[model samples]
Target: MTYDAVTEQDPLGMRGIEFIEYLSPHPDDLGAVFTRLGFRLVARHRSRAVSLYRQGDMNIIINADDIALSSRTVQDEGDQISAIAIRVANANQAYHHCIQQGAWAVPTRADVMELKIPGIRGPGDSTLYLVDHQHKVSIYDVDFEYVSDDHNPPALIGGLKFFGVVQYINPESTAEWIRFHARMMGFRALPPQTRFGILPQGTILQSPHGHFYLQLIEPVGDALFDAEWYEQLARLAFGTPDVPATVRILRERGVSFEDNEFAHPDTQGAVTAGLSFGINFEIVRCPATPESP
Candidate 1:
């Protein structure tokens, strides 16, 4: 009833993001991209159209079905983050709490797995699944029907862990989202002027444990993106221990990256040195920089 006190003394009751999900019209294409990025094809859902990939502690899901986009192709952009999974002490309890806070239920189709993965709506009609057994019992086996029984998911690449996602919202919508995460998920906003790439950024929100941070940035002034809503949410930043080394390993695997003069590894929206299926991941220096520097 108390939601396990994940947020009591620890406000934001935040746990790390459980997994990142993508809704792609070309599942095979996107899967190939991830594979090039060092992710292995792990398991498939028994009933729903979903596949799981693992790299280090980061989990990524590709939902092949257009159901994720209201029976339509979501978009073509590669780096877009369609959904993020959050680890809760108890998924059902967390789902209930969010629902009580006026969160809408996102439908999930369960097949092989006897368990039901609960999800709720997030910004931009995106979904946030409550996952607790990400590393527990063979969730893929119980829920997913893999094409090959011997297929194993790939190991984490470059010691990369999910740091947090970059959410680009309207110039004035910042306060609404800040409150949404705080009330519905127990996230605590960090101090101001926390910067990341080539751009000057804004307030940061940390998970309850202080292990994860989501950055909220608004376009300069009343400037809003002329693109679709989903296009704006595509910017995802991954944390890596060594930016230079991580870039090298990915390049050797046949991945392409953006290396223009203005959009270099040190620039905003610039993916590090790795490319997969022509898709690249933005390089973000880890929050915990070497103090010796």
Candidate 2:
């Protein structure tokens, strides 16, 4: 399918990340890591082996359901980011538009009790889910049951917010991926002078609504192709008003951070030591507004 640019406006009416999902064979193990990072288990999926954790405005879905479609893709990878759900004005229209833009659709099979959420293939085996944020009903309202008495999740220490996600791309494929996001999803490349946190060696693309970002990192200096790394969504970065204070708070919670000359903690940013399944989190010194210049 070929989709022409529908309008000058963002075709998807994209807002921000609804949630970042991780598929794992061991959900409890990964759940511990999230807990130490200050997330609270708020809900459980109605029909599957899935749970939702929240911190402030950020929502993370941990899918350990063996029967779930995305779980099959990450079964061998131990624990990996399987999908990123994006909030939009209309889920159906967004899904159709992306497919017309040459994006491959991931078939949906919602049961009689569930809502049929549309999705498309993303880099690697990941899926990009389209969810309508303007609707009166929420996707979780239909699929998940609340486990917490308090619906509002408390703020994370040091005022953390979703900064962006780091995606490992194939060597020399940066331009191609950039075009895919630009044409299909309405992401715009940032200027070279604008950098975020530490470990800044990638092309940063901001969502149309300027809420979150996608950092595309190509393998460095003639690096051989590693199927394990190519086109995979690697680490998640959270922006904090104070990096040192955030690190201190996490350290108190028994989270160890990498402390070295190049990547040590500072006002600019900090990197956490490898957590479950080589998943590391980056603490960047950025405003709550991630799209700010």
Candidate 3:
């Protein structure tokens, strides 16, 4: 399917989401949460207090950067999503194109022999990094040391794959973020009916590359949200061919999912119970491949 570039040139050459970075002053605490979700500690950052966790095609990085954590979206909100690295054809081109579209460029720091991935400020204090890691040495090879030689670990659940990211926005600001993604990134706004997972009130922005989506949701009804609500990347969602099977496997592994009427596990989708500080995972059902035995 050809991507809708919306008149503006998509210099990012967006491939898909390469990795999602989570920032925590006490980074050690997130390991167990990720492990319960089937991620394995596969690498350690060569210089910084960062570690990489992997599961199938997903790569998650935990950064213990106190400076980054201090600017978190809301007061008292701990362990926030710091950055999302988009795989691009050229990092410099991607960064410049985003800046031209009014995105704030994030200052980068690279020590001796370290690779500096270009990035831009995102919704809140979060950063959006652009990495060009095609065929040549992987960005990981330059920055992280392997904790496991097995690069291709099979997914613990039924081919668990990245579905999208959820962003909580202010009321009636959906169109603003929609235009931002359309002009800055090559994402197109899907029809209102196009939705995934159980939490249904949101706008879905589809990436031109891979199975990627960005969901923008705002509080509705008499929801009891913290009055200190600020825009931020809310949670990560995964696409699985078999939602029921994935839920069953994860439940056996001690990952508790929501069982209420709104988010109970079914053949269509399922959502995991929130880890402290608002870490949640949503699993959406996708079509199975013909090659599956």
Candidate 4:
């Protein structure tokens, strides 16, 4: 099979993963954090306690309802990213495929004026929802009977694009989870010895177009004892064309990063240009072009 054939195929209708949502009991605090990151509150779910925010090129959702949709434990902490919405060609088809592949269906608790959003189980008990924005119809309008005229998507900033996801897995369970991704989704393990900076030591699976990646890392060194290793899977690394500019924008906005000049990318793990929510963000060198094997 060709290289594209080997990786997970985007099933024609599959666009990239759209937005990652966080369900926080402390929605106000979380909203404050994101606003500092240059995100504007764009829309709200009709009847649920959920709101959508958008920045240059990213969309973030904050769900504060006590409804337990995923198998995860949602503490009031600002750490967890509870749900992710994948842009598919057909939301219905993608949902059906996931269910046939043994994905757990997350039931909707829509109110009288709410939309019934479809979701399935993701790794670490996360929720993955399929959204179809292929047509001009307003997604929020059909599913969400909102009355707001504020209907606009985020404008993608700089060359900032989603490079890939960094997922943490148990030390011994890497192979099992690898199989799960490979079979359930069309993910393939990178060559065994390839490595990235200091993280993502497990396997790397590329999407069909190679625009996004899923990097799996098992417990290594000190990470072994942390029972919450899987909880860290929600952390994402965004690739930018200009790290310094991004950092400047973030720093000015009161976003704090873990800076350590001794490190390769500096003392702070990721630089945020004058942006808030700096702790939850990281800056990577320009994304290297994806090459086919």
* TM-scores of all predicted structures: 0.80, 0.90, 0.90, 0.79
Please give the lDDT score at residue 211 for candidate 1: 52
lDDT of 2 by residue, 1-293 (tens): 11222353467777778899988778998899999999999999888899999988889999888676454643365677888998777788888889889999998867779988899998888899998877797678898899868766787674678888998888889899999988777888888667888788989998765667889998876555554556778888988888889999999998999988778888999899968877789998874454342
Query: Quick one: RMSD of model 1?
Result: 4.5
lDDT of residue 104 for candidate 1: 91
lDDT by candidate, in order shown: 0.66, 0.82, 0.79, 0.62
Best by lDDT: 2
lDDT of 2: 0.82
| Alpha-carbon RMSD, each predicted model | 4.5, 3.9, 3.3, 4.5
Q: What's the true lDDT of residue 293 in model 2? A: 29
Choose 1 or 2, whichever is better by lDDT.
2
TM-score of 2: 0.90
Instruction: Give model 1's TM-score versus the native structure.
Output: 0.80
